[model samples]
Target: MDDLRRIDLNLLLTLHALLAEQHVTRAARRLHKSQPAISHALAQLREIFKDPLLTRRGAAMALTPRAQDLQRPLEAALNQLTSLLREGAFDPHQAIRHFRVAMSDYAAHLVLPTLVKRLRDQAPGIDIAVCQASREAMLAQLGDGEIDMALGVFPDTPSNIWVETLFQEHFISVADKRSLPLRGKLSLAQWLARPHVLVATRPDADNEIDSALAAQGLHRHIALVLPHWSASTKVLTDTDLILTVASRTLDPVLHGQELMQFTPPFKLPRFPFQQAWHIRRDSDPAHHWFRSTVMDCSRTSPQSGEKQAVSR
Candidate 1:
């Protein structure tokens, strides 16, 4: 096509490396190309874009204003190109790659550790990083390569982003051992009357679960707003306030807490937890491997109505 001829796609990629390393030798090493070939690509790029994208400094290269502006767009394009050329079929056991992911404290607690060990044995060169990032930031992180994927919920997520439901995590009432609720399932009337603690990744998240309860014309009383479910375990153990948390959160010990699944005060929806990534990374082999590992963790975790017992 005409578009293909005008844009020497390979030049965009060479420029990306040149701009990043600020040295042809280093960039050549990264791209696994000969230094002279990268130089030729840079020359072609300068003529095509009609700008001296980079200039020589004392011992390194510096970007012109035009080059500075091209950083994000160029990196995004090359990453896309490289991802497309990558073998779509991912092989977990033989692959060597880095997979950086963003997840809530809850998900990190419930997942990842198991996979890290498996990756150690199955794919020794594979590197993994799991850190916390808000849903608002997930999209930008995915696009920029700061994170290849994120695990959590994104109810009001934007359309530009892509999400796959990893699993349906159900809620269970959790409390401290001293104040654990009755062992048997409590009736809806009994549940609504008790004071409760609500946990969320963000302030608006509190409203999400509350709004769902409002739709049924039945709502539970919330006595506290906590930052994470881990903190709630401490509250529920020391106090009688029922904390509605995912049953998966029960795995990690919290100073001896007791968890019980009680009949909801009304019909409660399952937490539609999922892993979301940008469309740009849809074809990346490394990204695919990381996502598949997380999905495997989710599928293997306890499913509906099953109980997990834990202690400090």
Candidate 2:
């Protein structure tokens, strides 16, 4: 530490230029400094390192053995310092960065398609890795920096985390047309009578649908409970099981499927589908761009009664 304090960093840059150019005049030109200034800097570098870093060999200047040893390491150190100083500038188009995100298949269905398409066209070198975890695990992973961000409904976020609503989504009840043959609006009695497929991230999760049903002193039978919403539409194709999921979850998977989507019999309040990250990443330029892109993509498929994006 004392040695580092004694050495001038600016002189090191001069030393690097001198070592590269191997001539005082050329080194000065490279650094846009006068020849005498570079020579003075070289003299100071020699005194600090206790070695003649550059020596005149015949008609041109050459590097000493010590200078040759310092060349690669000094260049690497300066490159790292340059990157550290420019950390605020994130060029998405040229950056080859990998981001890990935690989200449910439902959020993936809503955001991934447009996100991937945009990434392919705008930032070809960037990659996104998506993972699924329970809400508790997602929070923990965000805190531990295991994932860059998470997308879902985060109702009880911690003080150390930040939440931004990508969009507001409401429930859309779907059923196999061949089996239930339902249309626009499902009756409460008919909805309660059919077996349902419940998509819950955690086994003990009490979803809004169940809460709405419990409020009316009625409960539907859940014949199957799955963790992923990707296959939820396909699961209802040949069965009598009906599912009430976020409208966006069914958007991509409902094409050419024998399914009927209708309004839920009971009113389920629209929830904010959100993206969360550690508060530490709140001001990161790249993360800001990413979350903004996500919000924009989410707006592409706006829900009827949904609210606009809200950042908190």
Candidate 3:
């Protein structure tokens, strides 16, 4: 208890950096402190814990058994303390933060360009890393802190996640204007008969579009299964293959291409595009700022007039 009284909060931060980096030089670099200061802290830490927390192995430093035992609990405690300290307010302009966002290629195409531009203007010091992943992978990434937020449709949300609907979009059939006799529309039979390009990030999981068709005892001829939304454009442009994509996703991809958008004859459920985050970050100021910024960007994005009719 007396040792606890002698401890400074900064020592825990140094210990965290040291344990994470496993080298005094690296820890000092991470803490933005002089190497001697880090060594001094390590010395103090050794005195407090009555153990050489780190021991040199050849040229590298390694955590001792006692230090290894403290790693996880120390990291978790530090994270909790950091979160508590950050609850007051967020200043976007001055804060330097790295935000990791998991999004589909389609969402990145439609949303990230504008979101990045807005973030650059509003929060110059903040950096964003966009990762492409399936919804399941994204949820796992969120839980593990690999991603800060996820942007896409999540039909069934778990209770532990927090979701905010950004916008609603619906599917539109896109085909080469010249290759197919598509005059802005296709019948149910025509739509089903055409060879389609399906975008499925995970091949094993059934896409919502396919599931909806299966419910109605109908299925389209999916001649090509691509992992990305952008890949469908080349197939649609070069062949008679039709691709059904979200209206917002289609709008951006169709630019400079001969693709023509038409409403599907069969009714499909509208996509509720949302931003999801772990419930742990629901009240974090930086995360709140990020979510708010994304929401603002999604709301102000220019709508495609052609797809306006399909949006509900």
lDDT of 2 by residue, 1-312 (tens): 988999889998888777656778867886899998998998899998889988888997778889877876786687677667868588889878788999888888777889999999888888999999988899889866688999888777754567877777788888877765434456789788889999987667778889888988989999888897887788888788889998877754463367888788888999988888864455456776788778888775554322222323
lDDT of prediction 3: 0.78
TM-score of 3: 0.67
TM-score of each: 0.63, 0.65, 0.67
Record all residue pairs in model 3 with backbone atoms less than 3 Å apart, i.e. clashing: none
lDDT of each: 0.68, 0.79, 0.78
- Runs off by more than 4 Å, candidate 1: 1-85, 88-96, 143-145, 176-189, 217-219, 252-259, 301-312
Candidate 2 collision pairs? none
Clashes of each: 2, 0, 0
TM-score-superior candidate, 1 or 2: 2
If the candidates were sorted by their lDDT against the true structure, best first, what order would they fall in?
Answer: 2, 3, 1
